[model samples]
Target: MKKLKFTIEDKKIAELLGRQNFSTRESAIFELLKNCYDSGSKTCDIYIESNCIKIIDSGDGMNQDDIESNWMHVGKSNKGYKNEQNNRVLAGSKGVGRFALARLGNSAKVISKKEKEIAVIWETDWLTSGVKETSVDFSKGTIIEISDLRDIWRWKNVETLITFISRAYKGGDMKIHVHFEGETYNIYPIFEGIKMGENYVSKITMRYDSGKMRLSVTIESDEFRSEVKEIIKPISERYYEDVFDMINEIKKDEVEEPEQYLKELGDFSAELYFYLGRIGIGKEKFMYKHNEINKLDTGVILYRNAFSISSLDGKKDWLDIASRARLSPAAATHRTGNWRVRQNQLFGFVMIDKNKNPMLKDLANRQGLEEDEYYQLFKNIIGFGLSRFERYRQSIIKKIDDKNKIKNKQKENNKNLKHFLNKPTTVTKMSEKELVSLVDEIKDIQREAKEQSQAREESTKQHKYDVRILNVLATQGLRASAIAHELHNKRNSLESGYKNIIEALEEYGFWEELNSDEFTRVAYKNVPQTLERLEEINIKLIAFLDVILNKIEKNKFSQKIKSIKNSLEKIVETWSQQYTWLNFKLNIKNDKIGEFRITNDVLEVIFDNLILNSIQHNELKDKLIIKISVEINGNTINVEYGDNGIGLSKKYVKEPKRILEVHETSRDDGHGLGMWIVNNTLHMYEGEVVEIDGNQGFNMNFNLKG
Candidate 1:
């Protein structure tokens, strides 16, 4: 048999390695930069002109012999001696990285020189022909002049390119300068706008190596200090709780198998900066650009050997962060207000390289990570940290919001009290008792405010201790005042009950008559139909006392229980007795988590308002139906409250969440503070209530631990 060699067509070979390898024009440009860095270049300048793109690098330039051996060789890279590398790792290893020229342009000319040798030139009309080499004028380095442009680099494109360079290349010794039409940009302005946050919520750094993953997290949102923030202390203290509480908080995860993190995968590190409030605070122009960049190029980029992977430059969430954000849209990035640490709120990068993370391979297209086990493990480990950060972020945001709501509610309460005290009306003038009640309420608010100030100075995490009390008391004050004002007609039956008992006794004497026998006679066999009426009045009196205790009493902050079944079932029993005509049903599902970490008082506030709102707004046909379903999974407690009276009101039908706001109500007799209290109190428990749409009734679901 004769030895045969397969002929490879130059055009057919270029077709697969040129534009086909790079997915974006930015990626192509980045590949060329990687070449300069890999060549041990300390300084590189890029000039963008009207006709051509020129890149000049002060690196180990190619000689004529070197060009013929390596530069001309397809499917091969120039590595050996250059990568001895003076402590710098080579970024371009795929050999085909040079075809980036063909991806950006149809023709190119290269001039290179090495010490003590004549400078050489290489020319090619890449689309139509092959390469040619000769002598040239360049000395000590290389200059690549590319023409026949494919994609024009616009202002935004340059800005994006600079961002990638700033993030990826951290070698302080190397210098990169970009020259546009007339403007020159270094690395400063590309990211200075992102540092405008007053005080960042956190800057988390995580590293994986030696079969272990360690995270160094710094939290700095002092503005959110006075809220009930979830810290690592409590979690670390819980014996039954997860050591990795943040990762455990994930409700929906697509990754099923537990990949051994940092086992086969080599060493890598990630740094994430979370900006909660204002980004680019004062620089309006820069803020506009930063926000625009955040829409795409503003996420976690991947860097290999200090050079960025252009396709993974956060324009696409290779981290699957946006997917998690989509799972909880309420707290994700918003167009206007109330944005928490969603996907876009975080800016960061993950560093890896071919020598260390050889298994985490980029596809032949140089776009995505190969869909393999290594990629899955890489994402999973990083995602665990992300999920943990989300919980921490969500905790901080909820507490901040709860604190603000408390302050606003307190201010409104004080304002209303002052209005009533300064401008006394007919009711206050007529009833000294009502005036006294108003004075007591003002004193109570002042006392609670003082307690809050003291509690805040003691410990920010313990602020929830006061939050529980204040939420219950504030809602009670608002709702009680409104109901008391409107209960004039409802008092007639109570007055009649007292009048009947008094009449039966007053017919004789004050001291001689009003005894237990007289009470019993009114309770059992009074004149005609007084017995049934008296029994009903007695039950109403008892129910009234229970209401006073639940809403007006000081919150037992120490009463945090693991099982919500005891507390919730008790609530159902109490409500059944309190509203004798209403049918209250409680269903418990997935009691695996025991119950929840929710306080007893906060639980009452959530369910009470849901049930009360049903009675206040809708007419009862036979008996109002109140159904509560509680399910536990992991550490989260989910509860759905539904009533069979009516669907959502027309005013809040479109946006059912509107009913949870501070002064939103449908009933004339409603306090409007009921649902607001329900919403805010839940936030204190790391919980949130979302209104769900249904056909037959009003339904809302909430989580005790989110």
Candidate 2:
């Protein structure tokens, strides 16, 4: 090759890169900061005055030769071949960073000096007289001063600019200081003071033939810590048009596995930090300035190659957290499900190494990554990680709610007990003997009345609980019957298919051909195998139908006297299988308590309602623990049932009897029928139910006449 030269209009090219490359003034500033960072700058200072803007940095300054060859060139940089400088990876490579100055103002002055070198000054009018060089007094540093501001800079804009600078340059040893008038603010210290309430971290590394992609998510708060890891599948074609469609195109052209399509995209890693607001601490502990944290633009920030991506900065619903919350209100609210975390409650960075993710390139406009297969896959992976965190957070919130409820109940119970035990009395108007006797009588009467009141209250609550159970059982029964009917229909179809197969074989002269040894061997071998599989299916269907029928029949209330233990055990066994996440513990202190006049239906309704309430209302991540203990005292059998779940609210706890009121339920979806059924069933049996204090979950003590 003899020679190759490229020519372009300098003014036009600078304007294109300056105006088209950046979407916002903040991004333009970020580009300038990135240049300083790449120059091995340890400290960068920004000063915004009435006349001009200045960015000064203590970095490895460039000499006249380096400036003439590299700095003056557009679209070509020495950074492409040698990626690292000053023990740090270069953040800029396009040789367009100087356009940031043009984007900011019309005129610019740059003074730079390298160690043991004479200082040089470069002056430029972006529109004409491109650049002129001269001598300066600077020593071993770089200072950029620009005049003629392009846009109005309000106080809010300056605040946002400072925040952007703080978030963009967090890693490494560099320090950024901003000055407005006489006030000076440091970026690092403000960033370090962000207070969080809860945290969850997840790291997943997916391996392929070529390389591996690593994803790290950190959700931090002042109180909790959790982590999870799992492999996620790529998005379906119906969801996004990029990744799946591209893969399908590849398959149409070549014979290859679906996995091969993903393997070609290469590998990369991303780290996301989620800040879930303050916990049990005051606002004074926060590192972020008050105005900065309260800004409307606060959201999850995205970065590529150690610099913030301008398009994704201040984007509210990048992950669609708010829309998801709106769709599922129960999951997003504080008390209901607590499964959603909004965009405002989060701030983090996602870093993708350029060398690894070759396919994941930036768009020409610099708004976001290219809408390619790799980018779609990356979004799906991140969405999966966030979903996992939500589930974990929901469980934690449930536990906290349960603990607080129990604590508050205990405090109330203690206060009431103290009042009852320490009632004041006057003995001035009566003899000592009469006073003592009268006081004893009054105490006995008050105690008896209190016991009766509590018993009535518990009986009402038990009824409400019972009604809910019956409703759940009825719903489940209908579902089971529907399934059984479907199975019955399938069984009939299988029988018909069997008959058709046999008839077809016979009609096709298979029986006549069976006389031949070869035909006979094949028919005997294959026919039995097919028939055996059909028989096995028929057996399973019959067994399943029988189980369903047994449960339905047992639900019919009877006047028979059954062993309480046996009835409870059956109900427990059925519910245990249905809710495998729950732990059922049964303790029978007296084995010879004999039989009681209670039907299986009553027991099923009671047990099912309690178990259902625990499962539905519980917010804890741990398995629900339900304890059942029975003891024979005198002529009555005492039964205690309790669970470690979020108990009833204070209103319901104080007035336990109201729980039995028709249509009264703590849940938004409740029909308010379960507890009503329980109350009526117990009344019919002449049994008594009382709510017991000192137990963590919903505790009930009932006595059945033996």
Worst 10 residues of 1 by lDDT: 237-246
Candidate 2's residue-wise lDDT over 85-188, tens digit each?
55566667667778888788878888888877877777777655334455656568888998888877767878888877766655557778888878888776
Per-candidate TM equals 0.53, 0.50
How much is 400 displaced in model 1, in angstroms?
Answer: 5.4
Screening candidate 1 with a backbone cut-off below 3 angstroms (N, C-alpha, C), the clashing residue pairs are none
lDDT tens digits, residues 485-537, model 1? 45544565555766676666667665243344764476454333465567676
Alpha-carbon deviation at 663 in model 1, angstroms = 35
